[model samples]
Target chain A: MLFDFAKSPIVSERQYDVCILGAGAAGIALALRLGRAGKRVALCEGGGLDYEDESQEIYAGHTFGDPYFDLDIARLRYFGGSTNHWGGYCRSFEPVDFNRGYLGDDFRWPITHDDILPYLPEACDIVEISSDYQDRLVDEELGLRQVDFKYSPPVRFGEKFQDEIERSKNIELFLNCNFTDLIGADRRVRSVKFRNYADQELELRASAVVFAMGGIDNSRQLLWMERRHGARFFDRDLPIGRYWMEHPHFTIGEALIKSWDQANLYFALTEKMQKSLGILGCGVVVEEQGDSTTKRLIKDLLCVAPGIGAWAADLAGKKLICSYRFHAAWEQAPNRENRVALSDRAVDRFGVPQSELHWRKARIDRETMLASTQQFNAFMLRENLGRLQLRDWVYQGDEYPDDDVLAGYHHMGGTRMSSTPRYGVVDGNCKVFGAENLYVAGSSLYTTAGYNNPTLAIVQFALRLADHLGKVV
Target chain B: MNRRFFSIAGFLALSLGHVPLFRRYFPQRIKNGWLLKDEDV
Candidate 1:
């Protein structure tokens, strides 16, 4: 049943098999899966049915390094979460992402890719995308592989599953319910407390509690909880908000190439090449331009190399040449310093400290994009297909331009999964290190962020977490 | 016929014909589109 916490009658205490905070992709997926299995679920959403400026204000905070979107605007604060404004791009993480031991312990995931492979079909069904992913190896030597991505009609969880959740016999969705704190002791959560806009409070007791809050808030709330309650809730030593990551997006350069069938194709280096080059994953998108752009590129080329420019002009006349804008969205290696911490001075209306994100691109991040671009350049030169004219900043190794698409707004890591508490916050099953009944679900639990969009993998992990919570609860 | 003049003119014409090849050997250095040298690649 649906109940707006602001309007619904006050219930001092309620009980459920599982209490899931946040009704975004992860929370909704987990709640639906558990409800289908006849488990009582309390799916709590911080925001109401639609967007509200007051509700969004809670996400406001400071960004210390790099040019980033304001915390409040980076993600939506309504029922469907950020899915309300997602681009619908979907691709699963490659096996190399999970088993990257060569990159170091920080890059390794406790679980293998095979562990999540079984759930791909169901995850694809949940997101309304095809399960088949066709990847073609374009050049074996250069390790250039043309990857396939499935686009969703971009399912908004709130719009699509509202009726089902409302009609669910075992699920109770509470909108406009903001999580305040957990009331428990001895590393076992007994109840969760939430307050509505009117400051009316409600407490929910559940055998299991899952924090499916979006990537940043998961760490922000946990950090606040740790500061408020100390080691009473969970291990205090676990990195609460460290190792945060993002996929940096930049228009690397322009390219002139012979007309090919693959026009808006995604390409990434193979695992072997990544290991050889000592770089992370990078996805390059080649967007073919029209005749006007081709002519413009020929004109630019004519100013530099007249011979190649004349040849390119001739090719353009014959309709054999194509101009492209090469863009790249690459993975940022997890750095302990790049983290989300609580702001010392600022607090929300509820008096909770706001999130202060410390994020910057490392040298390896630049190398990852540069290496991928160089590989593409080599492929073009080797095949006699085209030439790549890199941007001045890229070739010169200057600071990343602020005007470009700075990032994909794909927040990942922070409350990452690892085998031990020293390396990460959650275990392989996404259970908090010392907390028995508390678990985390979302991209925040990602051990390492790959170049693909996090929504598909977020649903997969939610489904997986639901399966785990099913047998226990 | 002036044989010496003819030889010089013929030589000049041949050199002119191979100007494109000389241009190929010493290509213009453009600021953008910086191609990686063989060793760098």
Candidate 2:
């Protein structure tokens, strides 16, 4: 019984207390949080529910630390956004990622890990992940049992919270609606415009606007608006699409022995390791480099008791059910050069300019990978746990052995959050500088957290924004 | 006769009634057309 805008082209777009664009993890979570507080919320999204776009295309790609598999970025463009395609890997950002002055590129967020610490559990509820309000299990916080468990049930938001979304009286979701721009009056956003495949445009008037699109579309929409309206961010050398970052993932080598019995690890042990292990799209572990830090988080490598995969087919009685876990995510540094920008040329359907994303890794990024690989190999050897192997394709050219062969799925840091407007476009609360009521919620707000999946942190941030809006509204 | 006129990708080709635009040099329109291959399927 949700407000289904499945067939209709034009949906209603009137003024509301809050307007959240992109019904992905951030948008939907915030809508539910604010709606529960009795605030009228308008949740606008370009794609319809459940990865259900007929115009989608599929292809092959790599995820976490695995070989290239058949994947599709285009298959995602709907109400749920990319959350449908997510492998349920969930992890929180490490302390080192929240920088005072980011190592290379922009600045750190206006807020800190402690700022959003109180809202983690509420965020977890929205994601359907069993979590405490403050998931601070690691970092010698209280020294009382840190992050002993991990949760990511391969959950898809479409079916997971469809009922909850439908039942909320405060939230009104308009699916099949694509947000085009934020019409501004003075310093605040006056309204938001969107359309369905039928080519009908609808605009919503609001007091504040929160952008919740996925990494790619989020920047695409901002860049499109900037080009069309000539916003303040365009001229200031602010790193909008620049400093694009992601955790490079792929299995380097495998470890198998002559006497290998069944004894593989399902989820990593510590919360730091859990967050950084790159599983459930949650928690990341922090490792200190010679001068910096590193983490390895790749999702979707099933680790059975040990000889599990080897005997998965042979075991007749017990269906060799090998539980999958994301391997690792090497910490990635910021490079001003690796970015996505509006190609002076390309334009999309609604006369908005298309994004020409030029994503590439830097030398420091490769160095970190090599360092982690060597450290990991040594760790496995010292423990005499299991045979360790690195995928051949990943060890070739420093970091990106084969640029065409590797993966860049965990897109991060574009309209990066920083303390100063000169450093990044948005502040810690994700509000854009010089503009009030315009906030961005996504991985794009990260300064540099080294290969950590951003969904968990963003959920916390979305809920936190709701708390702030509650007091003000 | 116009190899330079177009290129095709997987995402756009599957949509029924939608035709993809692979402009060799310049894009002609933003309204991408769908494919007419349900008959072939």
Candidate 3:
């Protein structure tokens, strides 16, 4: 049943089998699975049914280092969480993503891809996408493979699961109930506290508490909790707000290929090539440009070299040459400095410190995109397909252009999973280390962020977490 | 206004005046492999 926190019956304390702290994609998926298993759940959301200025203000914070989207505008705080505005690009993490021990201990995920494979079909169903993914090797020598990405109807969790949650006897969703903190002693959370917009407070006692909060919030809330109550809750040494990562998106260059038919094509380097080059994962998207763009490119070329440009223009006029824009969204290696910390001076309406994100693209990030582009360019040349012209910023080693897409709003890695507390905040089961009943869900649990969009993998991990909670709770 | 003569002149200008431009922007023959260095021309 759904209830507004401020208007609900006066229950100062309630008890449940499991209490999920954020009703986003991950939270909702886990709640539904546990609900089907007849587990009573308290699914709490910070915002109401829609976007509200008051709730969004809570996300307001400061960003340091490279330019990034405003903290408040980057994510939605409503019942659906950020899924309300997500583009629904779905792709699973490759096996290599889990086996990156060579990069460093912190880069390795505690679990393998096969651990999440069983939940793919069910997770794909929740987001309304097919499970089948087709990948073809376009160039064996260069290890360049054409990859596939499934588009979701872009399911908004609030609208899609509202009726089901309302009808389920095992699930009770509370809106406008922002999680304040976990109240516990010595690794066992006794109760979870929340505050409504009206300053009304509610607390719930559950056997298991899962923080399915969005990526930034999971780390922010944990950092705040540690400040208030020290190592009593979990391991103090855990890297709770470190190793944050994002997929750097930019228009790397323009290309003129021959006889291209697809509107968009995705390409990535194989694991072997990535190892050989000592780089991370990268996905290059080739999107065909219109006739006007082709004409403009030819006109620009005409001024630079009249003879070849005239020949190119003639071919374009005969519909022989195809113009394309090359956009690449690649992985950023996890850096300890690129992280999320609570602002000491700025606090939200709830008097909680706002997130202070420290993020900057590293040298390997540039090499990942540049190296991937070179591979693509080489493919075009060797196959007699055509040529590519890199953007001046990329070729000349200038700073990233501010006008282009700086990064995909895919927040990942704080509270990342690892085999031990030295490298991560969460264990292989997504449980907070040193805490028996506290767990985290969402992209925040990712040890390594691959080039693919994170929503598919987020849902998979949520379902896996639910299965684990079923046994314990 | 002979089209053939203008085309020849354009070709000569491109071949002589734009060698560096071609070497910089255009596709070159991949002799060793496709994985060019970070400073790939």
Candidate 4:
């Protein structure tokens, strides 16, 4: 049953088996899974059904190191979380992404791709997409190896599953409930402190606490807890807010494709080639230009190459003049320096310290982009597929283009999972080390940010955590 | 020597300028395995 925290009378003490903070994709998925298994869950949402100006202001903080989106605009605080604006491009992480050496460092997923593969169909169903990702139906004659991405009609969890959440006997959703602090004694978390939009203070006691807040908030809360309680609040060597990653994406350049069929081949990567190259996930998209841009391109080409220009000019009124804008989204290796920390100066209206993001692209990230684009350029040229003019930064070695480089809004890795406590905040089971009952259930727990969007994997991991929690609790 | 060379060079240039012929026969002979189409640009 859904309850508004502001409207409800002050309860003496509320108790549950599991209390999940932040009713986003991860939280909602976990709540529903556990609720089905007869565990009482209190799913807390920071905002109500729609967007709120005051709630969003709480996310405002300073960016320290790299150029990044304003903290306020980067995420949403509403019931469905960032899924409210997610582009819904879904693809699973490749097996290579889970490897330790992929990033050439200590970073590695304690869990393998196989561990989450079984739950992907369920995750796809939850996000309302086709479960079958195989591309056998795409004609091979197109010369493109079909890479599958199931677009979610973009499910807003609050609206899509309102009935299920409302009807569930075991789940109680608290709207306008912002998680303030974790109340813990020894090694296990006992309860959580929260406040409503109206600043009504409340506390909830639960056997297990799952922080399903989005990447930024997940780390922010943990950092805040560690600061308030002590250094070893969660664990003795808790790497609570480190190893942050983002899928850095930009338009690398333009490719002149005489035919759409020829250009499509360069757009997607085959599994065989991806494995052979040991690439940590990259996708190419060929976006067609509009009429005005097409005319300009043809006019520009006519000055030098009259043969192709004449051909292009003939089709000005007949068809779309095929100038494909080449876009690439590549994985950012987890960098410890690129992290989330509590701002020493800033605090929200509730007097809670705001989060400070320190983000920068590593040298390896630039090298990988260069290598991948060069490899693609070579392949296209060899096959006589098309002529590709690479962006300036790609040809200019060693330095990443700082001017217009944008992240894919995919925040990952902070409470990264590891078997050994020295490297990560959480264990393979998503439980914070030393804190037996506390678990994290979002992209923040990701050890690596694969090029694919995080929503599908977030749901998959949440479901995995639910199954684990169901068996134990 | 100059006249003879010029005549031969002009003939070769004209023959190579035949894009249709190059599209039809050159790909099979070159064997570089590029998908050469016999269509307009």
Candidate 5:
């Protein structure tokens, strides 16, 4: 049952087995799982089925430390969440990503890849992605192996799952509802207060609650709650709204291949080589070189691969003039300082404190880019597969380029998961450490971001959380 | 013996043809200073 809280009469005090906040991929995925499991679910969405400028304004906030997209436009505020504009590139985290020692400094997950691997098949189905992530594709002509990604139809949760949710007997979707405050008593969330766009206030109780409000909102809402309701509201000491990370997408280099056959090698790398090189996966898209760009590529290539450079220069009208862009969505080193905090001065239309993000790339981020670029260079040189004219900033000092580039809009890691309370906000089970029935879903629980996009892994982790909650709740 | 010698010769010829020898000596240098344009070179 869908209720437009603005027009619908407020149900003063409702109770359910599970109450989910935020109707994004994580929230909707959990609703489907819990509903199918025959548990009554009250799924709350802050906005209606469509985008609204007034509602979207709630996301407007200030950025403090690093340059970033305006918080207002970075994430869509309506139903389906950011998936409304998702590009749907899907791949799983590397097995190495789960190993604590790989990243060090307790920047590791209490859970392993095996924990989430079981739910991937169902997750893939939900996101409309077919075929497994191909980690290795051989380009024998260039003697290189590359990783491949599968594209989703890019499922908008609102359109794709709305009808099913409306039809579900056990799931009640409350739209146009704003989660105003969480009322907790003695470590358990007693009830949550909410409002409609019409200024109608309501409250609900649940056996268990999950905050699936994305990286930004999950942390922002919790940060506000902790301040008003006391630090014990979420975690007493452990950080919240901190360690916010994004995949910094920037052009690392431009390359030119000898022919179309040689061009494919630059597109992806083999899983074997990636592991051996200790680098994250990335893709290279070949763009046709313009007249001036072609001249530049030739001159650049001549210094590296003189034979191929000469071939490209002399080649007839076969359109061999090409330059490639290395699109790397590498992981950001999870630093405590790259965070989001409640803005002291500003409040949204709902009169709630707005968020301010303090995000900056660290030394590890710079090293990863430099090392990964060098690894690709080595492979190209070893394989005799064309050459790359490195990006100016890559060779320049350690400072990263923040002017022309933008963050991946993949907000991750604020309420991170760990085994204990000292390091993380949520437990291995994605439950808030201090609160018994409170849990967090979505990329917010990601201990570290992988080069792969978050939508697939977001669904995978949500399903895993649902499976865990379904047993006890 | 003739077949073995011919196979080795073919391998060498292919390697020399596809993978140029000069690349080892004067591989594209990612220069430290500003990027060199065609006119600059």
Candidate 6:
């Protein structure tokens, strides 16, 4: 069975068992998983691969989280979604993280950490990281002694899995298509509308629709369509585009650790610690920030050894951009106020309502910064090998409601999954709370920022959703 | 002159030591830097 989806928009009356939207990490990951299970799938994505689109801009948009920090955040109008630009940070979300115990909100996730834990290997495949990083926190609920770190040969999935996706008989990847809105009957979402960039093709429909657009676009698209199309259709009874969260992380400090032979910060780890921490995939450095959480670069500390930097300098600016951004992928906590909602939105070139993110910090968010500073200091004290220094003019925040420069790469929790439709948009299994055959695939479903990053968790959840949907949807 | 004053003070202290003279006070906040405000959740 050959599936031919070229530049032509797939808006015909064909019935696919699964219609996945936004071919970024979440969308492509789920599509791949479902296709592997012999399920017929149609995947749609906005934007094109890499930074190829002439219009793609990182710093032009409003700051929901600092857009500048996420240099690789690109939406492919093509296949294999944003993984084309994503850094391969393959760390798992811990168990207690699933609960809303810390947030004090009525929200609780429908799924547990254990439910999606088994899909780590598949998640590794989706991220194109090593399968054997022992210390990379495998099923931490089962007794997390230390993290297992590994490095991806660091290839993005768009290039890595392009052949496989194209070759997959069960998967039909529809590129250059945008998910306009959803079409549902009764209480179930039956299909979603896909329009072409040139408007050559009309609205295409499928049986099941998944909004796999990245966090910002997903929130904007859902809320935009909801406002224009009416509230009764797309899970509108709940906070449709409210209570958004992003991990407010900053580059508080950097250090040169002499523990490894390379004696640099970012990527020189001995085979022993990598082995001790379960080496082979994710990169980790537990260093101190003294008393600041400035920019969101994974876990207060990261490293890029001298040799790699030397090789990178020769690659020139644009040539080595993807690799350089891939090196710097890391984040910390998700503060609720550091989110996006409807503002004085101006429509983008696509005529879709783009958000003016009121990405401000409240007094409560300051506690995390203070805590980050404290924690960094403690970690530096404990791990005595590295000498920590401020990146200079790095500690941006003064206090709570203090205007601190912060941003989050992991656009988490807008159409969050919960047991209750009132508190969330989807169920634990990634299903729309009230509607059948409607789903979401992105970091937006995360109830909290578990500090370990969302790609791993999103992939795991996507795989689980496929399994669950296979049985029921 | 300082010795004479010390001697007098020592005598006064000796006299005062026999009698209930002073009490102590404690500061708010604990040693670990945690402060307690209201008890309500």
> What is the DockQ (computed on Cα atoms) for candidate 2?
0.01
Candidate 4 local lDDT, A1-473, one digit each (tens) = 88888687456376799999988899999999999999999999988888999888888988877677898988899888888888888887767678645445556678898999899989999999988877542323322344667889888887898799999999998888888887778767788888987778888899999988889888888887877787434676577789888988877776555556444432444444545545556666667766676666667655545555576676655663467777788888788788888888989887778888898887666645545555555555455545454555554332456666488889898899987777788999999988878899999998888778889999999999999998777
How well is each residue in A26-93 modelled by candidate 3, as lDDT tens digits? 99999999999999999999999999899989999999999999999999999999999999999989
Fnat of candidate 1 is: 0.19
Sort the candidates on TM-score, descending order.
1, 3, 5, 4, 2, 6
Indicate the residue-level lDDT of A248 in model 4: 86
What is the C-alpha RMSD, rounded to one decimal, of candidate 6? 14.2
Q: Which tens-of-lDDT digit does each residue in A285-386 have in candidate 6? A: 343332122122212222322332332233323232111110112233334344455546456655665665645544434343333333333343344333
**Listed models, DockQ each:** 0.08, 0.01, 0.02, 0.03, 0.02, 0.02
Candidate 6: misplaced stretches above 4 Å? A1-11, A48-61, A64-77, A100-103, A131-146, A253-338, A343-345, A362-364, A372-408, B1-41
- lDDT (C-alpha) at residue A291 in model 5: 61
In model 1, the Cα lDDT at residue A117 comes to 87
lDDT of 5 by residue, A1-473 (tens): 88888677678466788899999999999999999999989999998889998788889899987678999889987889899998888877867677634446557789888998888889899988774765454554332446666788888888999999999999999988899988877778878889877788888899898999888989998887887777545567668888888988877667665555434333444445445544444444344445676677777656655665676676524665466656555778778888889898999877788988999877566655555555556665565555666666666453557775566889999999888776678999999877878899999898878777888889888888888888988
Better of 3 and 5 by lDDT: 3
**Cand 4, B chain, TM:** 0.43
How far out, in Å, is residue A17 in model 5?
0.7
Could you say which candidate leads in DockQ?
A: 1
Question: What TM-score does chain B alone reach in each candidate, compared with the true chain B?
Answer: 0.41, 0.17, 0.43, 0.43, 0.46, 0.41
- Alpha carbon RMSD to native, model 3: 10.0
Candidate 4 residue lDDT tens string, B1-41: 99999999999998877554222212221112222233312
